[model samples]
Target chain A: MKNAYLNFAQMITGIMVAVLLFIHIAVQKLGVILSFLGFKISDPLAFNSMMERARQGLWAGIYICLLAFGLFHALNGLRNILLETGLSPAKMRTLTWLIIIFGLIFFALGTYVPLVLLTT
Target chain B: MADNRPRENSLGIAGWVWAGNYTLERYLYLLHRVTGLGLILFGIFHLTATTIFRVQGEAVWNATMEFLNNPVFMVGEFLVVTAFAFHALNGLRLILQELGFTLGKPVPPIYPFKDAIRRKRLWTLVTLAAVMVLVVFFFIDFAAGGPG
Candidate 1:
C-alpha cells in the first residue's frame, strides 16, 4: 500500500481499536458493576464466562475485528519506526514486507483463540 | 561556499529522550512513541498468552490466572491502563491535528507571525490533561472493580 493509504488505515484502525479495547476491558473488568446494571454476567474473568463470551458469535466477530485492527495498526507503526531509524531503501522495503508477514501470522494466531470456541 | 560535510550534531535515539531545545510538544511526541511501543509489546504478549491459554484448555487458563493474581501484576496492569489512556487520547488529538481540525487557517507571516502551532500546542496540553483525568478514573474503577 502507498504511504498515504497506510496512514489513513492507521488512523481508522486506531479509532476502531480505541473503541473496541474500551468495550473489551470495561466489560471484562467491570463485569460486576455491568452485571448490576443488567449485563447478566457477573464475573467476566471466570473461565466459563470467558468461554461464554467467546462462544457468542457477535463477541467473537468483534474479537476478530479487534485482533486484525490492532495488529495492522501496531505493525504499521512498527514499520514507520523502523524506517525512521534510517535504513537503505532496499532494507526498508524488505523490513516492511517482513513486518507484513509477521502481522499476518500474529493475526492468525490471535483470532484462532476466539474462533476455536466459537466453532465448538 | 557551502561546506556540506556529514552533520556531527545528530542527536540520534538519544534525541527521543533529550533534544537541546524541546518544548512540551516535543516531550509529548517522545511520550507518544514510548507509550506506543510499550503498548504494542504488551498487546502482542496479551494476544499470544490468550492464544496459548485457549489451546491449553480451561484448567491451564485458570491456573495461569491464579498465578497472575498478585499485587505486582495488578500494579503492572494499572500502568498499562494508564499508558493506554494516554496513548488513546493523545492519538485522537494527533488525528484531529493531522486532519486540520485542531489547526487554524493559514495566514501570511506579518511582523508578528501566528499559525496553527499555537492552537495545536494548547490542544496538546488539553489532551494531556484529559489523559490524566481519564487515567485517574480508570484507576478508581480498577480499584473498586477488581477482576470480575
Candidate 2:
C-alpha cells in the first residue's frame, strides 16, 4: 500500500512538474520574444525586477506552485534512486524519513522567501 | 550443483554510464536519471542563493548576481539549461507512461515489447528534437554574449 501510494504520488507530481516547468520555460522564452519586439524588459536577474515580478499575483502564484511541486518531485525522485541502490529495508526506511525531514525544511526555506517577497 | 558466480551489476556507480550495451530506451533512462540528479542539485543551489535576498538585503543579492556574471558561471548556466531541457522532456515521457497513455496495452508474449516501444519511440524522438532546438537557441544566445 505504501509503495502504491508512493507510485501514485510520483505520477501526479511528475505531471505537475512537467506542466509547471514548461510554463516557466515558456515565460523565459516570452521574455526573449518581447525583447526582440523592442520591449526591453529589465534584466530578469536584477533583484528589483525579481521582487517587482514576485509582487504580482500571477507570477507569485506560479512561483509558489513551482516551489511546492519541484521540491516534492525532486526529493521523492531522489528517495527512489537511493532505494534502487540495494540498500537494506531498514536503511531504506530510515533514509525515507531523512528525505522527508530534509525536504520539508528545504521547502519551508524556499517558500518563505517567495511569500515574503510577494507580500512586501 | 555448479558454482554460479554472482553476476556483475552493470548499473553500479562506475558502470552505470558505460558498462551496458544499451538501446535507445536504456540511454534515455540513463539521461533522465543523470539530468534529474543534476537539476535537483541546481535547485538546492538556487534555493540557497535566492534565500540570500530575504536573509541579507537587496545589495547582497545584487552582489551575488553580479558575481554570477563571470564567464565560468555563464557556462554553468548553459549546462543548467541543458539539464532542464532533458529532465523536463524525459519527465513528460515518464508521465505519459505512468498514465497508461504511451505504454500500449498488455498482450501475449510474442513480440510483446515491440508495440510498447513503437508507441513511445516517436514521442521520444519528438522530445529529443525539441531539446535540440532549445540547445541551438541557447548556443546562439551564449555566442551573442547572452547569459543563456
Candidate 3:
C-alpha cells in the first residue's frame, strides 16, 4: 500500500508551513524597523488592522495550503496512532471512515470561509 | 548469596505499569496529537471568526477582536501561541521520523528523556529561539505600530 508515502507528503507540507511562518516573522520585523524611525505608531489595533490587510492576502494562501495537507496528514496520523494501540483491523477500517467524513466537513468549512472572504 | 531478590518491584502495579517495551513511535504519536489538536483549534477559531465577519459585518469583527484582546483572553492568546509553537516544531520532528527510518526498534523502559536528552535539548533550543524571534517580530509589528 502507499500508506507509507502519505507520511512523506505530510512532512513536505510541514516544511511549507515553516516557510510561511518565517515570512510572517520577517514582515513583523520590517514593521518594527519602520516604527523605530520616529513614526507615531502607537495603537496596536491600528497596527494590526494594517497588518491584517497585508496578512489577509498572505495568510489566505498559507491557510489553504495547510488545510490541504493537514486534513489528510492529521487524520492519517490519528489512524496510525490508533492502530498502533492495537485496535482490531475491522474496527480500524470503520474508524477511518468516520474520520474521513468528519475531515471532509472541516475541510469544506476551512476552504469555504477563506474563499468567501477573499471573494467578497 | 541466594537470588531471592526483593520482589524486584515485579508482579505488581509497577510491573503492569512497566510491562510494555517503549518505542519512538509512541512519543511521536503523542506529540502529533498535541500539535494536531492545537492547530485544529486554531483553525476552527480562525474560520469561525472569519465566517462571522462575513455574516455579521464589521460590528461582529470588532466585537470578536475586542474579546480576544481582553486581559483574560490575552492569557488564552499566549496559550494558543505556545500550542502553535509545540505543534509546528514537533510536527517537523514527526515529519523527520516518518522518513522510513526505524529509529531502531522499541526499547524497554523508554527513557526518552535520558536517551534523547541531547536531541531534545537541540530541538528545544531551536524552538525557544524561534519563539523569541516571533515575539520580537510581534512587538515590532503589533506593538510598535509597524503593521501598516
DockQ of each candidate, alpha-carbon based: 0.43, 0.33, 0.22
Query: fnat, candidate 2?
Result: 0.24
- Highest DockQ model number: 1
Per-candidate alpha-carbon RMSD to the true structure: 3.8, 4.7, 9.4
Which wins on lDDT, candidate 1 or candidate 2? 1
- Candidate structures ordered by lDDT, highest first: 1, 2, 3
**Which residues of candidate 3, in runs, are more than 4 Å off?**
A21-59, B1-32, B53-55, B93-148
lDDT of 3 by residue, A1-120 (tens): 356576566677667766665454344334466456665333334434534552476667776776766677667766655555555567767998998998888788877876666655
Global lDDT of each candidate:
0.80, 0.75, 0.58
Q: Count clashing residue pairs in model 2.
A: 0
Between 1 and 2, whose TM-score is larger? 1
lDDT tens digits, residues A10-88, model 1? 9999999999998987776655456567866557777887888878999998889989988988888888777677666
Clashing pairs in 2: none
lDDT of 3 by residue, B1-148 (tens): 5532123333443442345773544554455576676766666676576554544556665677666666565555445555555567666655554553425445575554446444344554565577667555454444443432
Off by over 4 Å in 2: A26-30, A37-40, B1-11, B18-20, B103-115
